[model samples]
Target chain A: MEASIRTGEKETGRKKVLISALLFMGLGHLLHLKQYLKGLFYAACEVLLLVFLPKIITGIGNLRTLGEAQPHLPIRERANSMFMLIDGIILLAVIFIFIIIYIISVRSALAAYDQTSSAGAKKTKQGLNKAFPILGLAPGVGLVVFFVIVPLIFSASVAFTNYSSPGHIPPNNTVDWVGFDNFVTLFGGDATWAGALGRVALWTVVWAALATATCYFGGMLMAVVLKESNLRIAPLFRMVFILPYAVPSVISMLVWQNLLNGTFGTLNRTLRTLGLISSPIPWLGDPWLAKFMVVLINLWAGFPYFMLLTLGSMTAIAQDIYEAALIDGANKFQVFRKVTFPIVLYQTAPLIIMSFTHNINNFGAIFFLTGGGPMVKDSTLTSAGGTDILVTWIYKLTVNLLKYNYASVLAVMIFVVLAPLAIINLRRTRSFREGEL
Target chain B: MQPKTTKVNIYTIIVLLFLTVSSLLVLYPLVYVVSAAFSPGNSIASLNIIPFGDGTTFKHFDHLFKNTNYLIWFRNTFVIAAATSICTVFIASLSAYVFSRFRFTLKKPMMMAMLILQIFPSFVGMVAIYVLLLRIGGLDTLWGLVLVYLAGNTPYNTWMVKSYLDTIPRSLDEAAIIDGASHFTTYLRIILPVAKPILIFLAIASFTAPWMDFIFPKLVLRSAHKQTLALGLFSFVTDKKNEFTNFAAGSLLVALPFILFFLASQKLLIESLGFSTVKE
Candidate 1:
C-alpha cells in the first residue's frame, strides 16, 4: 500500500515537471525564431549550441590577439590592450554562461515534461523552480555589474598603471604595469604632490567641519522656533526658511553671486549705504574670504534641509515627554535640554554624518560659486584655485589638463577617503530598518 | 489667578514679537527679489523695502523672455522633470513592491547592496560616467542628463517607496490572492490605490530632484538649447554681465512652480514624511 501511494506521488510530480519543460522549450524556440528574423542568426546559432549542442566549442576566443600584430608595441599600449582583452573575454564568458543556463533550464524542463514516469525528473523540475527568481534578478545585477562595478574595478586598476599619455595607448600605448607608482609618487615626500594634496585636504576638512556645524545649528534653531507652541506664523517661517532648499543650488549661488558682486552687488552696495564699509569686499577674489564666502553660501543652501529633517524628527517625539517635564515643574529650556536635544541628536546623528560627507565632496557649490577661483600662478596643480577641494582638483586635472589617468587615481583616493564615513552613517541608519520593515 | 493669566499672556506676546521680527529677517531677501523682478530701473543694489523707489514694472520679465532662451529652457526642464518623475516613481515603486511583498532569497542581499551603493558619493565615479556617456553618444543630450539623475535618485526613491509599502498590511495582499487576483493585479487595484499618498510624495520628490539638480545637467547638457533651467539660468547670468536682473526674473520663473507645489502638497508631504519616519 505504501509503495502504491509513493508511486502515485511520483506520477503527479513527473506530470508537473513534464508540463514546465515543454513550456520552456516552446518559449526558447519562439525566441530563437524571433532572433533569426532580427538577423541575429550567429547569436541564435550560439544560443542553440549552448542549449542543444553542449560540447561543440571547447574554448572561448582570446580577444587580445585580434589587435593588429606588432612585436614592438609600447608597454603602456600592450597593457591597455591586455586589459581590454580580459574585459572582452569576461563579457563573452558571461554571454556563454547565460546561454548555458537557459539551455539547461529549457532542456531540464523538456526532459521533465517528457519523462512522466521518472521520479528523478520531478526532483530536477523542483530545483529549477527554486532557482528561477535568481534568474529574474539577472538583468538588474548585470546592469550594476557592467556599468558601476566593472568601471570601478577598472578605475582602481588604473591607479596602479603608468597609462597617462599617448605613450600608454595600445600598440604604441603599452602601459608598463607599475604597481603603486602613482600612489608612491603621491605619498613619497614629493613637495609638489604633498603640497597640493595637503592644501586641498586642509581646506576640505575645515570647510566640511564648519559647514556641517553651522548648518546643523542653524537648522536646529529654525526647527526649535517653528516648533514653539505660541508661534503664530510658523508655516510662513517654515516656507521662508525652506525656500533656499526648493530653489536649485545654481540659481541660489548665482543670486548670491550678484549680491556679492564687487561693483554692482546689492550686498556690497547695502553695506556701503549702511556705512559699514567704504569699499566692496573682493568676496571671490581673495583666497581666505573666498573660502569663507563659499562656506556661508553652502550654509544657506544646506541649512534648510537639516531644518526640515529636524522639524520632522521633532514632531515624532512623544508629546507626553514634554508634558511630563512641564508637570514636574521644569522650565521650557530644561525640558528642551533633557528631552528635545537628545532625541534630535540620537535620531539625526546619521543624517548629520551624511551632511558632513556631502559637504566634504560638495562639487557644485564650489564649482558654481567660485570655480575654485583666483587661480594661483606658479602652481603645477592644473586648474586648482586657492580654495580647490580634492574633487575640483581632480576635475581640473582631467578636464583642464587632460590627465585622465591621474584624475582616475585621484577619484579612487576620494572614494577611499569618503567610504569609511559613509559606512558609519549606514550602520547608524540601519537601525531605522527596524522602524521600516 | 487672574494676575498669573495676564503674565502668561505677556510672555506669549513677547515670544510672538520676537518670532515676527526673525521672520521678517528671513523673508526680506526673497521678498526683495520678487519685488525687484517686477520693479523697473530697480537698482538691484538698493535694499529698499518699498516698491516706490523706481516703481513696479514687468520689463525685467520681458527682458528675461527676450534676452535668453527662456522658453526653450523652461520647456526642456518641464519635459525632463515630468518624465523623470514618472519614470522614477514607476520603476522605484515596482522594485519597492517586489522588495516589500515578496519572500525571495536574494532580496536581503539586493537591498543591502543598494544601500551600500547609495552611500558612495556619485561624484566618485564622475569620470567613468563622463567617459561611458561619451562613448554611448549620450553627451549634450537631455536624455543623458535624465539617465544620470535617474540612476542617482533610484536607490533613495526605492527605499522611500519600500518604507511606505511596509506600512501597508500583508493581510490585504493575502485577501487579494485568495480572491484569485494575480500579484500584478493585486498591486494595481489594491496596493497602489492605498499607497496614493506615498506615490504622490515620491512623484513630487522625484520631480524636484531633476528640477533642482545642476551638476549633472551642467556636465551633460553642453548645448545651450538642451540646457535645463538651472544650467540655462547660470549661463544666462555668467556668460553675460548685464543680464543679472534677467537672471533674477528667470529664477523667479523657475522657483514658482516648485513653491506652489510645496505649498499645495504641504499636508501630504508632512504625512508621507511622518509615516516614513514613524517607529514600528
Candidate 2:
C-alpha cells in the first residue's frame, strides 16, 4: 500500500502484492485511500478478534471434546458438557460473523484503493447515511444470532451426540459425539426405534395433509356458501365461527379435551342419558380414534382463519369473473370450480402450504388435547403415541423422557422435511421472487 | 340492486340447516366453558347439560384468584408478552425499514435469511435454548423468557413489516429528507405513523403467541412464581390434578379479552394475511 510510484500501472500491482503479503485488513485504506475511520474500525476488529483468538480456539476445541470427563469429581462439581457445547456454538457463531466482517473490510479497502486514479483525491467518508442500515440491523441481527442461530446450532450438534438422559446427562456423565448413531437408530439401525419412527413419520405426513386439506376445503366451502347465501345474519355466523380461531389454542384444546373426556364428559353424558349407546365411546382413549379426533378438532380450531382468508381473496376477485362465467352458461358450481376456487387457490396457495407446515408441528392440538395419548398397540416409543406428530414427539422426548439425542434427530428431520416446503412457499411470494420492493 | 328473493331456495335451506348444526357444535364447548366457570361444583360431571341449569356460583373465580398463583402468572405472562411485543415491533420495524429503504451489499441475503428464519420452528432448538438459558441465568426469569421470544420474533415479523413498509412510497422519506429531516426522524415521525396497521397486527400477534405457548415456558420457567398463564393454568388440569372448573374460570378470564382483541383486530389480521398472500 505504501509502494512508491516506480510507474503508475506497476505501482498498483506492487500495492496489491504488499497488501496481500502484509495481511493487514485496513492497511490499504490507511496508507492509500486515507479513509482513517474505516481503517481504524477494520483494524480494531482484527485486533479484537486477535485478542480473543485463544478463547475462540478453545471454544472450538471444547465443542469437539464437549468437556473433559471428570469421573473423580462428584456429579454436582463435574463439567456440564451441554453448557460447553452451547458456549462453543456461541463462539463459533461469533467467529462466523467476524469472518463476514473481515471479508467486507478487506474487499472495501481493496476496492477503495483500486478506485484511486489520483492519490487522496477521493477519500471515502464514513457518513452516518452509509451507516444507517448497519446500525439499524445490528440489534435485531444480534438477538437472532445468539438467541436463534446459536441455539439452532446446539440442537443440530446434539443430534450428533450421545446426550440423552439416565446414562448420558451431563454432570453425571459427559456427553460424547456419537455421529449419526441416533439418526441410524431412528432411520433403521434399531427395529423398535425405526418402526416407531416410520409409523410416526408416516402419520405425521398423513396428519399434516389431512389437517391442511380438511381445514382448507372446509373453510373454502363455508366461505363460498356464505358468499352465495345472501343471508342477513351471515356476519353473526362469521363471528361465531371465528370463536375457535380467536380463542387461544391452549384454552380451546383444553376445553375440547375436557369435553371429549371418555367419562363424565358432557358429550358422553348427554349421549348416555339419551340412550344413544350403552358404552361411552373412547373418543380419545382409542389410538386410531384419537388420530381421527385430533384432525377433526384441529379442523374446528383452524377453519375460521382460512374462511376469513378465503373470503378476503374472494373479494379481490373481480365481480366480472363470476358474471362472465354465468354469461358463458355455467352453473353456480361450475362457475366456482372454473373461477372462484382456482383464483382463491392461486392467491392463497402459499398460505395453504404454510398451514401444512404449521400442522406438521402443531404440538398443542395433539399435546394438550390427547397429550399424544392412547398409546399405539405395539408402540415401544414411550414418548410418542398415535396422535403424536414429529414436533410433539420431540417435545415429549425432551421434557418427559429426556431423550435429547432422539428428540434432536426428530427436530433435524422436521427441519429437513419442512424447510423445503417453507422455501417453496417463500419462492412463490411476489416479494421474494421480485427480490426487493 | 335486484329485489330480495321472496322464497328461500332448497340450497339455501340446506345450507342454513348445515350452518345451524355446525354452529351448535362450535358453540357447545364455548357454552360449556362459560357454564363450567360459573357452576357450583368443582367437577364437570356435576353440571347440568344445559348451561347454567345447575345454578351458577363464583367459587371457581374466587378459587382462581385467591387459592392459586393466577395473579402472579397473569403478571408474568403479561410482562413477557408485552415486552416481547414492544421489543419485536421496535427491532423488527427498525430492521424492516433498513431492508425496505436501503440497497446494500448484504441486503438481499439478509432479507432472504429473515424469510427462511421465520420458517424454522423455534422449539426445534429446545435443548440448545435450555442450555443457553441455563448458562445465561435466563431460566425462570421473565426477561430471559422475553429474550427468547424476542429472538424468535425478529425474522418473520421483520419480513412481514418490511413488506408492509415497502408498500409505503419512499417519496415520503425522500420528501422529509429534502426538508432537512434525519433518517431516524423520518422513520419515527413519517414511516411508523403511516405503518400503524401492520405494526398493530405485529404487536397483537407476538403478544398473543406467548400467552398460549405452553412448551417454552414449561422448559424455561421452573418456579410456580415465574409460571406463565399457560404453565400455571396447565398445572390445574394435568393428570394429577382435575381443577377443570378453575382452569375453565382462568381460561375464560384470559380468553374473553383475547376474543375481544381478536374480534376488534380480525379485519386487520385478515387484511394483513390477505395482503401478504395476494402479493403475487
Best by lDDT: 2
Best by TM-score: 2
DockQ top scorer = 2
Report the backbone clash tally of model 2. Answer: 0
Model 1's CAPRI class is acceptable
- Name the TM-score of candidate 2: 0.94
lDDT of 1 by residue, B123-240 (tens): 5556556656776788888787677666766666677677678778999888987886766677679878888887887787778767666667767778778978887767656633
lDDT tens readout by residue for model 1, A164-202: 654664445555456767777766546676667667778
The C-alpha lDDT values of all candidates are 0.67, 0.84
Alpha-carbon deviation at A137 in model 1, angstroms: 5.2
